[model samples]
Target: MTETFPASRLWRDIPDLLFPRQCEGCGVDLAGNGTLFCWDCLAALPYLKPPFCARCGDFVAGDVPGDFVCASCARRAPAFDLARSAFRFDGALAEAVRRLKYRAGVWIAPGLGAFLAETWRAVPEALRGRVDFVTPVPLAPERSRERGYNQAGLLAGALARRLRLPCRGVLRRTRGTKTQTKLSAQERRQNVRGAFAVRAPYRAGNRLWSRWFPPVEGKRILLVDDVITTGATVDECARALKAAGAEAVYALSVARGNG
Candidate 1:
């Protein structure tokens, strides 16, 4: 049986409908519309133009081609085999993401997930087959309890459904760390180091490994996150997966921070 929500209950109880819709970036009232942002606001967002670094997905100024890496990526390479993002985190897009992840705007996941799927479709064919399972960057238990949800998990769930892939919780936060936003690049790296652990009893073929044993043998994983800033969190997760014998690990984000 299909359960249906009452129209009045939906409009009155759902925060996205209850509150007057507004542009996440500029806070302009959108009346009783269901869209998160107005048309003008969406058009004004700083969409990532072409000529981006192939490795990190950061915008590149010059006309470079063929698997280019950014200056920062060249200095210290990322742990993940490859990384991709939907947009450069700036202007209205950044504000919308912030609200979705930090301010409890859970209703925005469908739009964000669809945008990510569209971007992933543009990736080279070589990468399309490397992703076996889609997993979100896990949040600490305490933080998840406080937030009532993990935005990355929500995005990953939607993306996995769209891509026809399994969504699994392969990695877990072993220790709580300070918010990466308040830290410098080097500090962010240090903060997330050794912060993640692969969960046990992982399903492998027709067998389940013992809780005391690792089961990430020869698996290809696609790690999902809301945004990539310093790349520290994903790096840590990748390192843990590699240590557990994952064949390959790639990352995807809805946006990449401009810093």
Candidate 2:
């Protein structure tokens, strides 16, 4: 007897044999594994578990009672109603985020975005709220031109598609600032202050190209980003969104940075 297979399967196999998929985390040949990561790297993903902040989603160190909000949130609350992340920014997750941001590893975005969508679904409805729109923390015009793309926007689009929501460009960066990597939390907050504005609707040369003005007033929004550190950036974005009459804003990111 002769073995048989579908033509579509054989066609797909050609690419797998010609150019094997590599693990996004470690750049290892996938060896027919259908995932973006190899078994080891997938298992090593630093997923954040419970016992975290009720507001900021920072991982708590020890056992805590119900509804633990971190000291940072208690001291100076974030502008967003709530926030959460899927993974801790370290090891494989950190490398993947860096690659997506600095090294043009846009291919890694879909996987990261999937993780974000999964994390958001796990949040209780009471906390996550009714998200009306999904939007990215905008990049400044100059920085955006230089980078060629916004990593946050890519993540936001992927996440919104999964959630079956309308993704819109609801905010714009008003100015460019220095990197926040080495800045103190206070400095970080100051740097991004008044740096964002709600992107207003505008008409382009082609009427079809024009964007519909986002109806944020009295509506909830979910801000998406690649990572959240001091939460300053997202908070600034939330500030702008709320000022524009958004009822509530919640932030969701692929990973949580050490702040």
Candidate 3:
């Protein structure tokens, strides 16, 4: 005669058995815990340190006596007032983001959101108070529908909650465009160019968040995203925000991709 376990035990184990949670970095079973990377791999992630570019947030080598500008930013300035990221998009962080992006890994958003919140808190005091509202970088409607949810939107909402700021959909992607992963950096720039626009309502009083704040008109905005690659995407997003009478635009991300 076979013996059965308690109902409570069986109920708790169902989800794990049906879909085992494993480390995104090492494949070790995560046991019911909601972390993408196991302890060891998470500890080994290469977190970004200071001396990065003031404009694009790229990691810079060597010591700096004062504010330094990366060659890329010097060549062409970004549209946003400032930019920062919590971590460099490589090693464990990169893998985790890839899974979060391509593998329906919404489970990882909590941990990533913590990193993003910490990044937001660290924004310089001089830049503080200027951010009137937070907005997520908009995805093309076709891509957003395909994914069923926008990862950047998830991050922005989580971050806004942490910062006690209202998250608003101030920007919209004008149309569908090609994926940026396969394109060259220059190609990536042109692909997203003119793809974003500030919606009419957000230009004045926002219907979704009017009680929280008057509107986006002539207000500073903090643009939230999952990662910053060539800075082109956020730059374009900022361009649209500025055009919509945003006094200034600042950008932040969970990870900063290689320049």
Strongest candidate by lDDT = 2
lDDT for 149 (candidate 2)? 80
On residues 194-252, what C-alpha lDDT tens digit does candidate 3 reach at each position? 99987766235446455543456789898988888888899999988887778888898
Best by TM-score: 2
Model 2 misplaced regions, further than 4 Å: 1-20, 31-34, 202-211
For each candidate, give its TM-score against the true structure.
0.81, 0.87, 0.82
- Candidate 1 lDDT tens digits, 47-109: 666688777677777787666678988998877877788878887888778767766667778
Number of clashing residue pairs in every model? 0, 0, 0
lDDT (0 to 1) per candidate: 0.78, 0.82, 0.78
Q: What lDDT score goes with residue 31 in model 2?
A: 77
Model 3: colliding residue pairs: none
Residue-level lDDT tens digits of model 2 in 66-138: 8888999999888899999999998888888887787555566777778888999999986766788899998
Please state the error at residue 204 of candidate 1 in Å. 12
Model 2 weakest lDDT span, ten residues long: 1-10
